[model samples]
Target: MKNLTDMMKQARELQSKLAAAQEELEKLEIEGSSGGGLVRVTLTGKGAMTAVKIDPSLFNPDEAEILEDLITAAHNDAKTKAETVVGEKMKSLTGGLPLPPGLNLG
Candidate 1:
């Protein structure tokens, strides 16, 4: 039927768009910071951490726990940002329709 043929064509186009978006995400970088900007994290759009920055003043042997906590916070921030970016990108590609909850793109 013509309708089935059209549906198949649309599916192929959507698949192409998703593949292109995935490639773009691999090349995109998102940054997030915390601890009054004393810590920063950079991650790829695919949620891989690429770099971490910590304020020199935070380096104290007696207070290493604080530094660890800050690093964790920064990483989480970066991850959340990456998810938001991916979600926005997917939304655009899907004509504003959000993917199902808990759907893992990776």
Candidate 2:
């Protein structure tokens, strides 16, 4: 009974920490770039896109496809970084507890 009580208390604390971590993630930002830095993307830790930048040289009517590809690559890079950040935060918050695989938090 004592062990159960202690475990419940820890669960409550972990839940609180998880909520705070999620809120903090929303406020954090990460940047990723591709195509030799000609394209850049910024995303919040929660995987929301905040901004995108492209070099003026890449803005050519004949290179629309190239531009589109670069933008997609940059966005993917930023999203990957955001996922890594969130994963690290969650790991810390959970004290490295092993969660079931494929259970995405977001």
Candidate 3:
């Protein structure tokens, strides 16, 4: 009974820490760029897009498709970075506890 009680306490503490970690993640921002820095995107650790930047040189109407591709690349880059940040934070929060495969946080 004592061991079970202690386990419950630890579970509650972990839950609290996980919630705090998620809140902290919302405050983090990561930047990613593509097309040799012609395009850039910023994303929060929670995977929300915060901003986008594009070089003025890529504004040609004839290159709309290229611009679109660059934007996609930059957004993907930002998303990947955000995921990595969240993963690292979760790892720290869980004390390296192994999460089941395919169970993404977001």
Candidate 4:
């Protein structure tokens, strides 16, 4: 019974820490650039895009497709960075414990 009680306490503490971590993750901003810095994207740690910037020289109508591709690349880069941040935070919070399959904090 004592062991069970202690386990429950630990579980609650972990839960609290995870919640706090999630909140912190939401507040984190990550930036990624592509096309030799001609395009950039910013994303929250939760992977939501917050902003995008593109070089004005890419605004030619004929190069719209290229611009679109660059934007996509930048967004992908930002998303990857955001995922990395969340993953590192979760790993620290869990003390390197592996999360269950299909479970992700990001």
**Number of the predicted model whose TM-score against the real structure is largest:** 4
Whole-model Cα lDDT of every candidate shown, in order: 0.90, 0.90, 0.89, 0.92
The number of the candidate with the highest lDDT is 4
Q: Model 2, 15: alpha-carbon shift in Å?
A: 0.4
**Pairs that collide, model 2:** none
Segments in model 2 whose C-alpha atoms lie over 4 Å from true places: none
TM-scores for all predictions: 0.90, 0.92, 0.91, 0.96
Model with the higher TM-score, candidate 2 or 4:
4
Q: Which window of 10 residues has the lowest lDDT sum in candidate 2?
A: 97-106
Cα lDDT of candidate 4 equals 0.92
Worst lDDT run of 10 residues, candidate 1, spans 97-106
Question: What is the per-residue lDDT of model 4 for residues 2-106, given as tens digits with 9 covering 90 to 100?
Answer: 999999999999999999998998899999999999999999899888899999999999999999999999999888988888888999999999999998787
lDDT of 1 at 90: 89
TM match of model 1 to true structure: 0.90
lDDT of 2: 0.90
Cα deviation of 100, candidate 3, in Å: 4.1
User: What lDDT is reached at residue 54 by model 3?
Assistant: 97
lDDT of 1 at 106: 41
